[model samples]
Target: MGIEYVSVDAEYPMCCPVILCDICNKQLTREGVALRMESSTPQEPKRSPLYFAHRGGCYSTISATLEDLYGSGWLELSDNLKDFMTQLAHNFNTPLEHEYTQYKLT
Candidate 1:
């Protein structure tokens, strides 16, 4: 199979990481870089939503962090409010990152 690469400009309140290829949804990590890619480059219209609008990456980190607690001492919390705050803290991180990314991009 051939590879393809597309760039996304997701800005904040919607900030997110620089996803290298929109087609395959590849992320650019601190660990490595995407060196080469090949594909039948689709003609991304200049008026595409990705071109005209500013968007942020999907927020996933908070859910993931809260999920982590289900397996740990966080399960010991008896108050529902405490649990809710913890969940909220976890969820907010991704959106916060999105904002940070937006600021940097602009």
Candidate 2:
């Protein structure tokens, strides 16, 4: 078989406003939040150095990736997944300690 290109859905549901959260996959009907990761250093990795994550998915799906990366709690997710995400951030020179980062529900 030949390589097939995937297409993104351009249509939006009418009943409810679909929103994807950058952090914590919590959909919001009203205005939500957004987070953007950018690396402007002299030395950067291949691919993209800038990443945008928006809460309450408004015509965007990048936020979905953030959700899958970081789950409900730090222990809830796998070390490999966290490492992968952190490594991506590190590729952009992110000064975050993967092991130090915690996601606990109170």
**C-alpha lDDT score of every prediction, in listed order:** 0.28, 0.35
Write the residue-wise lDDT of candidate 2 on 58-78 in tens digits: 314554554476432111122
Instruction: Give the distance in Å from residue 70's predicted Cα in candidate 2 to where it truly belongs.
Output: 12
Q: TM-score of every model?
A: 0.16, 0.21
lDDT of 2: 0.35
Clashing pairs in 1: 3-38, 12-15, 12-102, 14-56, 15-98, 62-90, 62-91
RMSD of 1: 21.0
> lDDT: which candidate is best?
2
Clashes per candidate (backbone, < 3 Å): 7, 6
Give the residue spans of candidate 1 off by over 4 A.
Answer: 1-12, 21-23, 36-106
- The true-versus-predicted C-alpha distance at residue 49 of model 1, in Å, is 23
Residues 54-81, candidate 1, lDDT per residue (tens digit)? 1123213322333353321112111323
Model 2 clashing residue pairs (backbone): 19-56, 19-57, 20-56, 20-57, 21-55, 21-56
